[model samples]
Target: MSWPEGYGRLVLAQVDSTNAEAARRAPGLAGPEWILARAQSAARGRRGRAWAMPEGNFAATLVMRLDEPPEHRALRSFVAALALFDAVGALVGDDAGLALKWPNDVLLNGGKLAGILLESLGPHLAIGVGVNLIAAPGAGQVEPGALRPVSLLGETGVRVGPEAMLEALAGAYAAREAAFVTYGFGAIRTAWLARAMGIGAVATARTARDETTGTFETVDEAGHLVLKTAKGRVAIAAADVFF
Candidate 1:
């Protein structure tokens, strides 16, 4: 599919933190939807963790200036995750065992295939994404699963290029943004829950103060994970979920 107009002037580089670089360039950039991509990376996910971006992996960031306030900023991360899902699903097919984990992680056959990170740079938000297109690196392993983080080429035996995936993502993000604008967060929430990994599964949530075990319920409108614990329904804004 063709990319949206004015979204293709990507700044390609050999190495840099996609999130950092995007944030640095966001203030000076006149366009709202500019992309930055690199062949390798030195930075990783949440909490300044380390992520290994090999030559074959896809590391990119898109900077967007939204009209909404900071309280609703989390919606951009959801949009980014859904966009990445659509892009990877298109290359590997819908039945490729792709699913979305809450707060922004893409799973393929119950293994992490991609991760989304969102950072706010003043009024603009930089949405960074890393996808395992060829090989899954071990430097940033978080958990183990049956699939062991299969890539697009490994799962489908097809080499998917980074440019093509970025184009697809841009299109998907446009569609998602349109839906969010017209119908509000309800539309995206439904789509996200449909492909959610732990919506109906029993899982453990590790929060800062306490850890709770409960069955995963649907995400609320404000973008919090609603867990049905033995005691009652708990709305968690931040936590690590494990099954």
Candidate 2:
């Protein structure tokens, strides 16, 4: 695959976490960069949860400096999700079982296939992505009631190396980035909603202190998840969603 133009790339045998590596290099970067780790000994998910990075899985971070409002920067999660949807769809040669979950998760055949985490490192924003391309963690490894982890190979018999996955992902990300920069988030939001899963269905969103059960509605202009609850329509900034 052709690497995207104007994007820097680094492949490592291993790392503590690709996000950590990006934070170290962010200050020196002149443009967007992708850092890929074949293995991560101390990777993490949101809220400081440990992330599993088995051999052959895809672990990488995209670091870039942006001059925009916090809300605009936050929208990159949707941008990254769309890029991943495109990249994985290309691998499986169809979009049959692919769906994008709210906040930051990719579903394949109704199971969690990948996850995205965004962190602000001083002046740059780091978007870390992990995909189960070869093997998924056991059901016991995840939280209770969480969707079972799934792998591309196990689900579709598509075996892809981490490096190759980065190539496709980077190219897809570049295109999505261009769209976001040019047309603003409205275009990206529409595209994301089209591929989003579980619209008009009942789901539960759990936050730190409380849980809200409501019918899934569209994501708002500010990227807040809108839900139609028994009380009224609610816009949630962040939550763990379950259908």
Candidate 3:
């Protein structure tokens, strides 16, 4: 199939981590933007954890070159999240029980519908996204409080085809990329916060060092989750928050 302007081509494989495959192919590719994968055998999420990807799930990775400085890299995650949110929302419904979690997670009715992983590949970056189209895998299952994972078909009673989802994602991503390049991360930041799952609610997060319980503040311009704890406001760069 002929890919859209921003998207070069969709490379589908039976199995392999899209992020890992994209990382390996990024150096030899001519352009900076291309998507690869059909399913992931060993998908990964934040904190170097594995993301379960069974058949019928949507697994893909987008490779792109950013002109922005290193400090602004987090904007890419916001953009990717916005794209997935918009695409999935359009397919299901505006109020399709969809919400964007901090960093890059797509939640449906308070459960995880999709998750994104962004990794640096030399001068380029690979943004990997996994969505539960039919069934969600039962690996790396976390606690059941706030940050629980859900699936698309499980929520909407509608089976979203992987190819269709990819098309929508590519289109949404292209539009968001153009806006990010032209207007900067301000626009994306505003939209992301608007679709955020919990803004002023209390949440709990665990990191490698310690655990934090605080109010969910707005995501800062740098894409860090700003939390208001008893001591003071702390900017969390990486941590899984339980809403």
Candidate 4:
């Protein structure tokens, strides 16, 4: 299949972290490339959480040189989530219980099936993507407070290999990125909210200081999650959400 313009591919038998590899190699690298690893020893998720990517699961990071502004860079996480949601839909079908959690998470059957981590170095951003394809982490394997982990294999009784997932993801990302460039985050936000997992539900968002409980409202124009509590609308930029 044809890849996105300017994209190349790389595979590693093993790597401590594909994102770290991308961060190191992107500066010297010429164009975008997808770096995938069979196993990750030091994988990580948002907020310094240790991400457990077992051997059979999928670990991939897209390395690309980006010269966009800081605000534009911030929007990439949402764009990435939408792209990944598309990829998941391809495997599980659009009618499946695949939904996107704001910022960077994909939910399958109301459980987390994938995560995204974005790291920037100069003009380059290493967008790391980890999906649970063959299996989700067994109990006592993952960090606390992760959305109950689920896997495509467990949900659909089918094992879609990592290579095929990557191919679909790359294509989906290219298409979504194009739409983002042309129409901006407004369009992306609309599509994301359509497949959003929790909009009317009550959820708690814990920040560094304290946690706030509210009705999960819509994500605002700037992409901040808008929560409606007794004290009007709370615009949350960063928090761990629990439903």
Candidate 2 regions with alpha-carbon error over 4 angstroms: none
Candidate 2 on 1-243: residue-level lDDT in tens? 589999999999989999999999999999989999999999998788888878899999999998777777899999999999999998779988999999999999999999999999877999999999999999888888889999999999989999889999999999999999899999999999999999999999998899999999999999999999989999999999999
* Candidate 3: 10-residue stretch with minimal lDDT: 139-148
Off by over 4 Å in 1: 143-147
lDDT of each residue in 1-243, candidate 4, tens digit only: 357777888888888899988987987888889998888999999888888887688999998888988667877888889888888787667646888887688998888899999888789988999999988888677657757899889988878888888888898898988899899889998998998978999988887799988999898877788899999989998788888
Q: Counting only residues 3 or more apart in sequence or on different chains, how many pairs clash (N, Cα, C under 3 Å) in candidate 3?
A: 1
Residue 89, candidate 4: C-alpha displacement in angstroms: 1.6
Clashing pairs in 1: none
Write model 1 residue lDDT over 1-243, tens digit each, in one string: 887765635657765687777777787787756565656557668657677676767888888776668768878778778878888787766745888888788888777888888888888888888888888866336544322566777767879888777778788887887788789888899888888897788977776688888899889999988889989999888777787
Which residue pairs clash within candidate 3? 112-150
Give the candidate number with the greatest lDDT.
2
- Residue 231 CA displacement from its true place in model 4, Å: 1.2
Better of 2 and 4 by lDDT: 2
Instruction: Indicate which candidate wins on TM-score.
Output: 2
lDDT agreement of model 4 with the native: 0.86
Tell me the lDDT of model 1 at 184.
86
Cα-based TM-score, every candidate? 0.92, 0.98, 0.92, 0.95
TM-score of 2: 0.98
